[model samples]
Target: MTPLLVGVLGVFGLFALMIFRTPVAFAMMIVGYFGLWILEGSRAASAVVLTESYSAVSNYSLIVVPMFILLGNISSAAGFSRGLYDAAFAWVGRFRGGLASASVLGCAVFSAVSGSSVATAVTIGKVALPEMKRLGYGDSLSTGAIAAGGTLGFLIPPSTGFVLYAILTEESVGRLFMAGILPGLLLMTLFISTIVLISYIDPKAGPRGDYVPLSQRFKVLGRAAPLLAIIALSIGGIYAGVFTPVEASAIGAGLVVLLAFGTRAINFAGFRGAVLETLKTSAMLYMVVIGANILNPFLAVTHIPETLGNALVGWGLGAYGTLLVIILAYVVLGMFLDGLSMLVVTIPIVFPVIQQLGFDPIWFGVVAVIVIEMGMITPPVGLNVFVVKGVAQDVPMATVFKGVLPFLLAMIVGLLLIIIFPPIATFIPDTMFG
Candidate 1:
């Protein structure tokens, strides 16, 4: 069989495994190794696997992955998310649908620290949803807001998705992180605006609430200082060249540890849990990266991407047309696959095509992340919606899905703005690094 045929089969088979309830990492690893053995002889494929695994794991740049994860784990353990949400509430909670708006902004801030959508959804939903219910917010609107907002974790700075994308594409991780900043904020604003508009049109959807006292507001803000400090130090240190991205991660992790202690939030038991969780999660990320690294070379040998890329470019779809195709593909895949796994599965093939079509890699990374964010809130496998449902078990699944629709529309707008303007995502990265 032609190598191209083998590559195509591998792609479909990987999806089949995922649909059959296989773990994403295991499915990718199995298909990749098996495909390699078929394309080359088993002996050659085994040797390549051994060497690639070692090289991928030993690469020093990868240490940033664990450092960032550790930072997030520590912050989560320290209860930083609650402070962020509280502060956001104090500032925004007086508006009609104010709590829902606060949920979006709060999720954005918590996302900066946690960088995991499920974590953001559950954490914020736990804290914010019941409050919204008590305040008479509609169940659909309340559940949907948190579920949709949680997806910001993937697009925002300090994002694990962006980090993984940069590592795979060999883009500058710092620049990718920087590129995410504005677009992330833009999406957050869009989400908040959507909430306000919905509440304004149908006041019954979200009731107005009493404002927090100025003194209490200040107290909430004070509680958020540590999180704000860590965000500023980590992002600012990298941008200022005071430290490399890796060093910034180390510094961030260190700060989170200190914050945990300062807050007296981490007992020995909590600390051990944080460490073990970070270690376990980090291992999973590394395994996926290593497996993708092994699989990428095999895909390359097939020349399938090159063949498809040239054909699409020859079709003269122009930049926008090509981008539409990519986005459409992501939307479809979002239904069946988890976002990170979808990214890994497609990026090796798709990124080269994007670069060939003259799109900036950093900009494309942001665009790609936004597309994946859609998947997280989209059905029938919207991961974020499921997370929200877990938090509000009595809320129907359909209601959770319904809640995300407006934000999803806002996300669509945000994605289009990034596409047309480009600089919205690229400006910071270019100015800082250029």
Candidate 2:
């Protein structure tokens, strides 16, 4: 009967729906609508739903979602992913464990294209896994690298995770995008270093790649240039204040579409398929936003976030100790829930605790995103690991999980560095926007 009780029921019910195979978006929408009805009657609930849905859909900044999704989809359809992978291979494929390293690099580059971790994993895995196998690379190392690398999609600029975090917390999407850059590169470096260490311990696990001539490398790099340039122009333009995030997204998508057709890399049929895929993905994201918006209001009325924040701050745990608790909780939730689901479900409660602790919001965003990406390759529900498994069909799921263990460790180290330095996530944003 009490609002707080309804809010508690709504949280459990949301998880129950998700556990029962209900879509996260619809589940949130459902729980929030009915809970509001219970707390304050149907008119408020209906109005909340109507207004939030319209607001979510009509928000101009949100245009970035479909545009970026289209940019990624079109790039995938046009075979630009292959071009990027090939360029990476040419550059990094000569050293020990280089093929696996190349996969990481390829994922990092392609992360700038696709904001979704699954899309990044699948696209690069399709290209990198086969070549690694043919070159006699070990399954665990190859699959693990691709899976780990794919998580860059969640941490890098143009990331869906950032966009959703922005919408939820009302942070600047552009600053969050900027915040992600160095941390993403830091994680990429650590992943490559992990491959190096693995190779040093077991050379046969990651055999050295054959030589690639300088001329060949440059030639392949040239082939990969258009998409890279588009990525640069779009992301760079945002930082340089040359364009807004919405404009940058539209420009990126338009340029990729032009490149696809101009190079004859994608036909009308392929273009149509890309558009349809974009529509589906964008719609799902939009619905999630709407649902989160609707649910946030109900949660606010119950004062659950405020209560949690107070409880957390009341504890003797210092800022770092409280942070440790939150991170550990995320790891547990991540084992059962997908990254986006974990994100939306927790941020309302978590964000307040974070802000009350006097931690930097932008910095925490990177930390939160990196931790979620860790979940993408973690055990049980490891989303990116399964994506790599799906692509590298012969590799066992356990092998994929085992392979990611080292990279996951690398991610932790990278995360720790960010937590300690803080500048790793905030420096660029402060320098750019200040």
Candidate 3:
């Protein structure tokens, strides 16, 4: 059989495995292993798996994943996320749809530490949803805000998306993280603006909230200061060249651990739970990374990415036209695939095209991550929407999906602005790393 045919079969087998409920990690691993065995010898295939698996597990830069996850997990366990949420509510809960706005803000803040959308949504939803409901905030608006806000975790600093993108493309993690800073904040602002527009159109949908006095607001802010400080020091430190990503992760994790125990926020049991959860998440991410690494070499041997890049550029579309096509394809893919799966499956093919078109990789990373974040809330398989529905079980699934529509549009707007003005995503990274 021709190598091109082998590549085609391998792609189908990968999808078939996913269809049959094989874990994405293992699905990629299996296709990669046997694809190599067919093309190379069995000995080479076996060696590739072992070497790649070990390489993935032992990579020094990857320590950021586990440490950052630990920081977020421990912060949640210690109830620090609650303090952050309350502070947000205190400041913004008085305006029309302020509760919803505060939820988005809380998600953005918590995302700085958590870096996982589900965790951010769950953490904020638990604290924000009940209050919004209590204060007569509409389920659609409130739940939608949290659901969309939670995706900030994918774009903010220390993002899992950036980490995976870096790993796949061999880009600088710090530059990618810095690149996301402005765009993440922009998306967060757009989400808030959407809430304001919705509330204005249907004030009853998100009634105005009670205002807190200044002294009381500051008091609540004081409660949230520790986590905020840690977020600043860890993420800020990275931007300031004070620490590498690995050191920043360790410092952030260590500080959160100390804050948890030192303030009596968590007992031994809670600490254990945080550690266990971190291990599970970190292990899962590591496996996906390993799977991608293995699968990529196989794809290269098949020359699929090269072939695909050639095909895309050969379509006679100019650079921007090709990019538009790529973005549209991602939107379609996002409807069915989760964010991590999309990143792993598509970036190898897409990254080459991106480079060919002369788009900045860091800027495209932000663009790609925002698109993935949109997928997290897109219908048919909106992961974050499902997560929000899970949290607000009394709220109908349809309502949750309905709620995210405005935010979804807001994400698209943010995406367009970035595309039109690439500097929104590139300026910070360029200034910092230059």
lDDT, model 3: 0.93
Superior candidate under lDDT, 1 versus 3: 3
Cα lDDT for residue 332, candidate 1: 97
Instruction: Choose the strongest candidate by lDDT.
Output: 3
Candidate 2 accuracy as TM-score: 0.99
Q: Encode model 1's per-residue lDDT on 311-386: one tens digit a residue.
A: 8888898878988988999999999788889988889999889988888999999999999999998999999999
Which runs in model 1 stand beyond 4 Å of their true positions?
A: none
**lDDT of model 3, residue 3:** 81
Q: Which parts of model 2 have CA positions greater than 4 angstroms off? A: none
Task: Give all candidates' CA lDDT scores.
Answer: 0.87, 0.92, 0.93
Which of the two candidates, 1 or 2, achieves a greater lDDT against the reference? 2
Query: lDDT tens string, model 2, 256-298?
Result: 9999999999999999999999999999999999989899989
Model 3: which ten-residue window has the lowest total lDDT?
14-23
RMSD of each: 1.2, 0.8, 0.8
TM-score of each: 0.97, 0.99, 0.99
